[model samples]
Target chain A: MSGRPIFTRPARLAAIVPYVWMLLLFLVPFGFVLKISLSQSALSQPPYLPTFAIAMDDAAWRAALGLLSVDSFRLLLTDNLYVLSYLRSLVVALVSTALLLAIGYPIAYGMARLPLRWQPVAMMLVIVPFWTSFLIRIYAWITILQHDGLLNQVLLALRIVAEPVVWLSTDSAMYLGMIYSYLPFMILPLYATLSKMDPALLEAANDLGASPRRAFWSITLPLSLPGVAAGWLLCFIPITGEFVIPDLLAGSESSMIGQTLWLEFFTNKDWPVASAIAIVLLLVLLTPLAIYNRLQRRQLEAR
Target chain B: MRANRLSPFNIICLTLGAAFLYLPIVILVIYSFNASRLVTVWGGWSLRWYQDLFNDSAMLAAAWMSLRVGVASATLATLLGTLAAVALARGEGFRGRGAFSGMLYAPLVMPEVITGLSLLLLFVAVNAERGFWTVTAAHTTLTMCFVAVAVQSRLSALDRGLEEAAMDLGCTPTRAFIAVTLTLIWPAIAAGWMLAFTLSLDDVVIASFATGPGSATLPIRIYSEVRLGVKPQINAVCTLIIALITVLIVTASLVSKLSRARGESAAPL
Candidate 1:
């Protein structure tokens, strides 16, 4: 105990390495983003004015600052479409997280209850699909959900419907695609938490004359809260910024935050406004992001 | 009790869930072998698309470019990530450690579109041309965080006593780490490297913003081609990518299983 140097000098120096890299690469780039957001939009070579033109006199500096208006932000606030798109993305993300948890919890519970020898292979099966190219998976969905696609062919053959329904480019299709793509993220964590749980607690609950369902509700669900939180955060964060799936699967109905941001930057070339939307998006997500970091930090320190 | 057995309710849920997860990709793999030019039709099986893919020069270049980026970035990311993990797992008191850790972990789940846009803007502001190096930089930046997570978990689980004993004996801190700690965490580090490689190989959104003309990565090429229609050529490419990733994952799992089976008798988890 006496030999332990908790705050060693070598370790402190080692800590500086990542900080310096983050300061230069991570923080400075974010500062650049803030500066660009404050800049004015224009139709020029760079499509935004006064970019790193630091040679201005004091008088020119004021003029440049004045020109670097908050109009992009103002426009974002005033526009109903922008506001609704943000809300829509949030709604979709939350709903998708819910769907993932509902479907994933049972599978995770089942896998966790299986014999120990089969657990590793079962976990691998869940993960291999997740590790595959995300784009290819989305393509697979498109093929399945298209009007004359696989789903339609099967339904027609089975006489489930008289004709092939228009399943692609609809809200239902978008939701299905989102859940399919993100289900693994939900299952992995839930399984991790559930599989490590003590079986005796449930046995005790049952031995105390509680029904099996009551024991599950009283013991199992509450116990898996950590997994549920982790799984929810994992699915929610990325879905808010999801673009490719919605763009591919939905018609003009779904206006996700990522889709709006992409259109502003790529199609409209509105760099200032696009940056503003991104900055606003970050601010909105700041709470969940902080909570996520805190949760991770607590986990790290708990060990 | 009967509850320990697989109930019919759970059996149904497990089967449906498994089918939902696997059926799409399974069908895609099956369709990749179809002789029909159209994705919808099921003609006799043939390897014509695979042969056609081999003869396509543009795709060949994109594949080569993606390979180069994956290898280079995964190497650098593994090095830097291991260092960062060392700092986190072994480092003592340091100011702003919480915030520093946040920076490392935040990007793992950050929206790819936002990251792509922000990094592209940074490049434009600095007047750096977007191309291979930029894509590599973006990818390395992203993958390093994942690598750090893997290595950090392993390092944290390591026994402090072994390293302390080495330090007690005449070994310096660096030498102690190299001799005692590195050997234990080496497999985890290698797995993280492979994970980073697959991540970079499959990335498209970030590479889209970061790439310039004649430097399209394989995913970017595939994205453009798949946008107009799902061509059979892309099917061939996607099948190959799946095969490669599947092989890597199976091999990694097998290694872990073998190591665990042997180590279980020797040490407790």
Candidate 2:
């Protein structure tokens, strides 16, 4: 007998190692966040009350559960600051994602149509900026969008404006940063799908006398929907909770939920409130993420 | 053929998009060498900011810590992530496979603030010290998911026949994987490691949440300084990072291409 098992001992151990590690570090932390979210903010070492002990007996466990309250979430509902910031974040995410789609589609199409040798080069160009420091990229904008910065200098020299434009600390500058930072995320996925299209399909359309625009609408756009969906989720989900761009480039008055959570946790030391914001943000993101997962699984199965 | 050919419209889109993507960082690089104190004045090409960057002790210390964290986390993440990828790609009908993959992909879409907050809370609950180790653990947990995805794609695309042949030749399962599968997927694993390292280096929000008072990374330091305003020294640091990454990537591609050419020529012999 060969005596070789289907699931070898080492294979089982290897799989279990990562599974257990993820269970401990990745999955368990959310439970802690959830528990803290239901607790009261207080003046303490850990900054929350009614911390749960796994060693507690059933009665003590029940008692701890009873002490947990939803006041933090209630505050999220009642506080104009929390509610408005959530709405603002949603609006910003939606607008920015739509802008990404509009701007990314043409560029990705152009990339896909490039010669085989140039395609990889174009892809690398998109990725190089992505590899650069995210903080530095955002900071780079502050230099250009400042009132007397290079953008204004160029605008003034061209007589596009009578004076230097007040670009920094404006929503316009904030959106510019958002679009610039997230554009690669949008383009990469779109290019993946676009580049895989059969040129014969477009050739057939051209032979049938369909206009390029007509072919794009009837064929290209329909085929690229999956990429559009992928890109949409990629950009929209994180942008909803974006802390950096809005914090750095947006006006002080435009407080998104991410900044709110940051201030709550760091400045005010309100861990409960911050946890509530995180939980709610996760809840808001779950639907799209589920859809994305389903789509990915289907693609995997098809493969 | 029409679709393959570049039209004027496509050319314009490519040009404009490239400009939009690249212009800001290029301008920032140019400004890094400005001799004048004012950032916009274009003070005639000096390395004053780069010189000051060398002398800033806090920034230097933070950079050192970041390098340490990047190496540690990237190594850990690569090992775990490669294992996870192999298991998912090859181990069919494993229990909790659905849940395993869910855990793998969830972090990719999960917001950084949520991840950071949750991890910090967990550390606090466990009474673990919130310092360099905690930050490394957090970065490893997050970046490993990216590594897993990258490696998994490569693994799934690999021909399993090679490993099966090795096994048929009396190699053990582990030896077959080592000689065939691991060798084939080495590039993906290396790419995954680099991706994880850069991600650990670039992360600010997660590090900020996970970090203690004295364990700030380079991005965290740059972030705090940036909040105060754009400084020439920070620009110089950013320029150096960009240049370093560009050089590494170019060299990697050149080496890969040369090796590919050599392999093609050798195969005919």
Candidate 3:
């Protein structure tokens, strides 16, 4: 403890380095985005031009602020296609999350209840999927879901359908891909929480003559809400901004906000428009996250 | 005790879930053996797609570029992450530690499209050239945060008493850390490195924005190809990647277990 007070040169440098690096690379880029959002789009060159402080007058500031008005919001809001896409994405994310929760919970619960000898094996199964490249997994879904693919072929041989159904380039296929990619995220945390739950509590509940379902609702569900919340947030947040799944599964017809944002930035090269879309999406996503955070804090404090 | 028996519902659910997770991968691998241009049709079982995949120069180049970027970015990220974890764990009274951690973790949750777009905007404004280096930089920036969090957790769980004992025996602080602290936390560092490597290899959204012509990563290449139509060769590539990852993970897990057993056995009772 005596030498701990002395400032070591290496210690001082290590403490400051990560923050400086993060600021320069991460935060500075974030600020640059915000700055570019306000600048006029360049016609001759790239999408953005640097506008010095002297160039930004009161009128310019007002115009920048005006871009955030109800009219722009309304334009985005009332566009039937945009609204439909948002709803479609929401439904897909919600349904996929539900499927993941349903599939993941039983596995987690079973793993948690198993003998210690089998625990590592069960955990390994959950983690092994993550080791493969994510894109490869999505590509695998294409092979399974495509016409004349494995699933369709099996169905056809069984005479379930005379021909292969067009499963790829559909919402259902996109949901399948999204859930497949994110199910592990849902399982791991749920398992962590469930494994930590005391067996005695369940035994006691059983002894009190409550049905298993009743005991589960009364004891297990509330106790595992933290993990549920965590799993949901993990799946939901990433799924909201999912571009690759929609791009691969639903093709050009999919109108996810992420794909829209991508087109704005890369294809259209409209930084301001893209920024506006991103800002809106961020605000919407952050609201639920903030609420969840607050609720989680309160839950922890109660404990 | 009676309830411990495997219920029919539980068995059904488990089987279906496992099939849902693994069948796609199995099918992809199987289709790769089909000798046909049409992905839907079964001409005959052959290794033609594997041959085709190996012969494809563009795909091969993309795979090589992805490997280079993943290795470089993961290495840089792990170093920075380990340093940051050391600071956070050992350095008390550091200014704005919470804020620093928040910024580090922020990108982990932030949408990839937003991150990619913002970084692209930054690059455009600075007139920075986009290519391999730019993609590596972007990946490093994102991967470092994940590595830092992983390392931080390991550091927090570590027992500091060993280092203190080493220092009391007249070793310098740096020597104490080298002897005790690092030895215990090396596995965590390795895990973080593996995670960072996989993430960099898998990344497509951000890579698409930052990568230039002839510098496409594996995911980007697969994505562009899939945009045209699915092919059996892509499935072949996916199967190979999955196999490689499975091998790496099993090796890492076995090594860690062996080291842990050795450590426990070496301990004096």
lDDT digits (tens) for residues A18-93 of candidate 1: 6776666666777777778888888896888765567778888877777778888999999998999999999999
DockQ versus reference, model 3 = 0.48
DockQ of every candidate structure: 0.54, 0.58, 0.48
What's the DockQ of model 1? Answer: 0.54
What shift in Å separates residue B199 of candidate 1 from its native position after superposition? 1.2
Number of clashing pairs per prediction, in order: 0, 0, 0
Candidate 2 Cα misplacement greater than 4 A, ranges: A1-13, A54-63, B1-3, B258-269
Better of 1 and 3 by DockQ: 1
Give TM per candidate: 0.95, 0.96, 0.90
| Fnat for each predicted structure, in order | 0.51, 0.62, 0.45
User: After superposition, which runs of candidate 3 have C-alpha atoms over 4 Å from their true positions?
Assistant: A1-13, A53-87, A251-254, A291-303, B1-8, B43-45
Candidate 2: residue B21 lDDT (0-100)? 83
Chain A TM-score compared with the true chain A, each model in order: 0.94, 0.93, 0.83
- In the predicted model 3, the residue pairs found to clash are none
Report the Cα lDDT for residue B202, model 3: 89
- lDDT (10s digit) by residue, model 3, range A220-302: 88898888988888788778878898888875665888888888777978776677666677776886556555543343223
Q: List chain B TM-scores, each candidate.
A: 0.92, 0.94, 0.91
Give candidate 1's error at residue B196 in angstroms: 0.9
